[model samples]
Target: MTSPEGGGPGTPAPLAPLPPSAPLPASAASDLVLPRYGAGALSDVVPSALAALGVEGEHDLLGLPPSDRYVVMLVDGLGWHLLHRHAEDAPFLTGEGRIRRSLTVGAPSTTSTSLASLGTGLPPGRHGIVGYTMAIPGTDRLLNTLRWDTTVEPLVWQPHQTAFERGVQAGVAVTTVSRKAFRGSGITVAGLRGGEFVPADSAGQATAGTVEASRRGDRSLVYLYEGDLDWTGHRAGVNSPAWRHQLSALDHFAARLRSALPADVVLLVTGDHGMLDVAPDRRVDVDSAPQLRAGVRMVGGDPRLRYLYTHEGAAGDVVATWRERLGDGALVLGRDEAIATGWFGEVEDRVRPRIGDVVIAALDETAVECRRDFPMEPLMVGWHGSLTAEEMLVPLVVAD
Candidate 1:
């Protein structure tokens, strides 16, 4: 395995020139427009895609053509900016004939929420995986979606049926190609339900599985995942050569798949979220920042964006303090304000508790790290889970 970018785990990236600051619009609540397909929220995109792929029902995101196979290669953490930056390494992607921009996952754009959203065709509000680790409503214990370690059963915790399941019920052959270990994992059960799981431990195996699915030439939906780029970026900054090498590997994999699949098959490549290099010097340890930690009960989500649950009656004070301290680097909003802003797309009744009493969205290239609690390795180097363009925006490249 390749070593990560920035120094060790918690070491932040060298600070780059800060981007222009843009606060989340005060009217964000009423103007909730789902990114990308713009049907509604992130949840609406997948179903729209399935519908376009000719899958019956309102839940299919890609509308597949009859007798045509559909392949969706979700490259974990391969942000649009990262792809454009490392175009040289991803020749097949950059040189592709047609590539379009896709919407970033919702606020605190982490893998868990985004993946759940894509898999279920529901927004974080519906799926209820809002952040990295969030408190289960009415319960003190936190729920870890990535690991699926929780008191609640994984299936019941996120009970929303997936687009894959709906497709299978509609007689569409559905398949998921990912690491062999994920075949029976809780995360897989919760997100990728109803799909025939194909174990692909290596890039070669992943490509082979995808090609084989496409060759079937029936109404098939093949979901493939490549996680190395995100892994490299998390360990090393996105600028690291190791990350670039991973991009090259993805490019080769794409080229190989394209060569193997029939021209009529449609292959859509996208990502869960983007990443930002947070330098060690810039890391604002929430534990150290009294103003940030004031009245906070728990800190969930990733470093770039965090969910701060304040003690009873301290919500207003906590929001004010965070806004004052983070200034233009982040947008601090009260719970009602966040929900009204429609940031999480129609905030469901059950999902309300998943959000923090005060939500913090990082704007510029800044991140809020918890030096005291989070594992040191994840705290360092490349961090994401924000609403910035770099982290929110992804690409939609199609190969026919």
Candidate 2:
């Protein structure tokens, strides 16, 4: 694996915390660091690329080269640090001599929320897909954004028109390539709708779909998605042999996608969020801890960052209890404090209640989880969604 622009693989450099341009209170900086929005953000990618290619939109943040044909491929959970650490397994990504830069995903650093940011060209606050699982506000039931709980309508929950819509309106032929099962799923309707939905089950199929769409017109924009790497990371920690095998496959996939592209086309590779392996001892079961469950009506989000909904007027008690119990392992913040940190990026009035009364962001390898509430969640080996560098920093690599 080598660095972009003709160099050998650089040593794996740990991501630094998000730096603040303006003064932040010592307390706030100690607990949270918000996503860097206007500049190097995942939400800035597609919009800026489109603008460079003559399809204008609300964003033009990252100055991607102008190209008539483009393929934006997102590898789920491929954090910048993870890729750098395992560069030997991903030669194509680290070897190619193009442009490379780091990008930050939206807060809560989960799949659905990051996808919404990518498609809508907005932050978590504006897109309103704040977490993996969040409340429907004024209701006790949790709305799993990934599953798209039937109780909530996707469009009503996320009313913004997507970047796909913008491409279509500008007469740029747009296509979305992903697993066939995701064709009409709730998350798709809310975030990835408006483009030609092409069902692609394998990497070859994804490449095939993109090529077919690209040849259909003189100018084209195809979105290619692959999730097997993320699936492997979840079942077998990112450092495990299974995950390394998946990483090797992704390196080949990157080469395959590029080999099949037209000479004029530009291929961009990126991801939703990064992953970190959590040891068994680091897993804290909140369901079994009375202090964690006390005064808490429901638990939302994932293991790394948990959203706590409390009983009527018990918000204060819940905050104090979680801080006391979790101590330095987690930072217990009120909803207002989290928002004030600008993590969600100008949370809309309608989106406020969806956030928990008290949010707990795990500070290290520790995971604040409730196993029984979401049975499948706790069984995973890799976890993300925190202010940690491994969870927030992703790569934006280009091949022309």
Q: CA lDDT, every prediction?
A: 0.73, 0.83
- Steric clashes per prediction: 35, 2
Using lDDT as the measure, which candidate wins?
A: 2
Please write out the lDDT profile of model 1 over residues 211-265, one tens digit for every residue: 8876653577788888888988888889888888888988898888888887777
Please give the lDDT score for candidate 2. Answer: 0.83
Clash pairs for candidate 2: 2-9, 2-94
TM per prediction? 0.87, 0.91
| Over 4 Å off, model 2 | 1-33
| Top of the candidates by TM-score | 2
